[model samples]
Target: MNTATGEIHELWEIREEDDPRRSYAFGGRHGQFSFARIMAMLAKDSGITGDDFRVFFYCGIMTYEEGGATAKEAAEFLGLTPQATRRITKKLAEHKMLLVAEIIGRTIKYRASPHIISALSGRQQSEQAAAFHLPTLPGRSGSATKGRTNDTSRPVPRTHRPAGTDERTAAPETEHTDDVRDPGRPGARRRTHRG
Candidate 1:
């Protein structure tokens, strides 16, 4: 299928598990029946029809990464000018559907919140919520070990060391030996400590 945007080129009927959904392929890129569409269908069944499905669909599509589109890039993708894109992005943010992060110089980068990410997939109820949770940054992955007698000011998480070895195991026992230190001790000192 031509990934280039224009008209709905082809409709596909695909099966997932026991359920089936329609799909559309464009510009060599493929997007099937969106979770947003399913939600819209359900909403129609329940009696809520005032919502903007088209905007939600585009927002979900925007959440997806394609060579990582910036707001300007997204604007171009939607045939919108940069300023118009900014307004739409703000609206999405106000709805808690998108997250606006970082402005380097004049460029703004945004990402969708986990809820929106999951909502795009009918699986939003099952896996998307947890999967979309942002991963911890480096050095903040886990909690510090307690009573270890080492400076834990660093955000880096604790790592495993061989049994019975303290973090300062490299120091010479004779230099500033711990009471447990005996140069001749079972794990004899491996190196001399200058300070």
Candidate 2:
């Protein structure tokens, strides 16, 4: 069965002889939980800090209501300052572990990395493996740098060169040959001279 939040409400019927060694419930557990274990492994492998792990888990779980939540919202939910939330989100984005799914004037919505989502949903190595292999999110193609486009197939427009400069005339006279000597330096030796 699934909860109203869409998460599977995993159930295990207890039998007299069956002593459950571990519990996967959300609360009331005295020891480490499965989610915590997953986060620990993710943190160690990805070099993310404890705070980052907390923020990441919060975002991953709370994002069910909306496609994603803004940093301010996440901060409020996690009881962290907005600046701290921004810093953590920025780091996660730089590492490609979080993506900006949407942007409104001053608000940006974030989504977990596809790999992280797959892992958390217990589908990391199963029939739904295709979801784990998705490419990094869009808007990361480097097309916005200095107003340039990333489409290399389109030819770039050429600006008119100065009167004295052209493909043939732009090169210096010494550039036509293979000589590596610098003639402008007075103390420089000719290529055929003694060492």
Candidate 3:
């Protein structure tokens, strides 16, 4: 239900009831546990340290708006010194976890990337497919074949070289030696056949 104040109801009370802390609760795991955990993990992975995640969680997850608080406002809401909030906001910005935009005044707002949100919400399955290797897309020159062969028979594109230049001149040749090659300097050159 939309409150008379125009705030849309979200699952679980966001803050203390009837205290104007902007808290509302709808009972369910979706609101209370899952969403909160998503926010917490996003904050952590995005490089928000200290108790900044707490402030970020409250402001970002509860408000339902990417533009929740300026650094000064966050400091006030979190009861932190302004300097502390500034430092935290700076770090968040450095890590690309927060976005700073200028409206009427310079406004600092934070939100998890859409990629993170989609993965967290189960709307995107690719993020969870890390355990399995996906076959390369059709018509693409994938590296190997089903028989565990190198598939060197397949033709691959060669780099274009300028006039009077050969493959060796276009790309540096490397020599494999039983003796250790000093990586600090250039090594000797060796030749191999190309088709």
Write down the lDDT of every candidate, Cα atoms only.
0.48, 0.59, 0.48
Q: What lDDT does candidate 3 reach at residue 106?
A: 53
Per-residue CA lDDT of candidate 2, range 133-167, in tens? Answer: 33222234432222343333554446567786765
Enumerate clash totals for all models, in the order shown: 6, 0, 7
User: What's the distance in Å from true for residue 114, model 1?
Assistant: 2.3
> What's the true lDDT of residue 145 in model 3?
25
State the lDDT at 47 in candidate 2: 54
Give, for candidate 2, the lowest lDDT window spanning 10 residues: 135-144
Which candidate number maximizes TM-score? 2
TM-score of candidate 2 to 2 decimals: 0.43
Clashing pairs for model 2 are: none
What TM value does model 1 have? 0.34
Better of 1 and 2 by lDDT: 2
How displaced is residue 134 in candidate 1, in Å?
14
Q: After superposition, how far is residue 66 of candidate 2 from its true place, in Å?
A: 1.8
> lDDT ranking from best to worst?
2, 1, 3
lDDT of 3 by residue, 1-195 (tens): 676778777697466656765444654322223365345444534334556566545544533444345677777878898788877665544433444433344555654333222223453434533422332211124523233333236434464667777635455555454445555667643344455
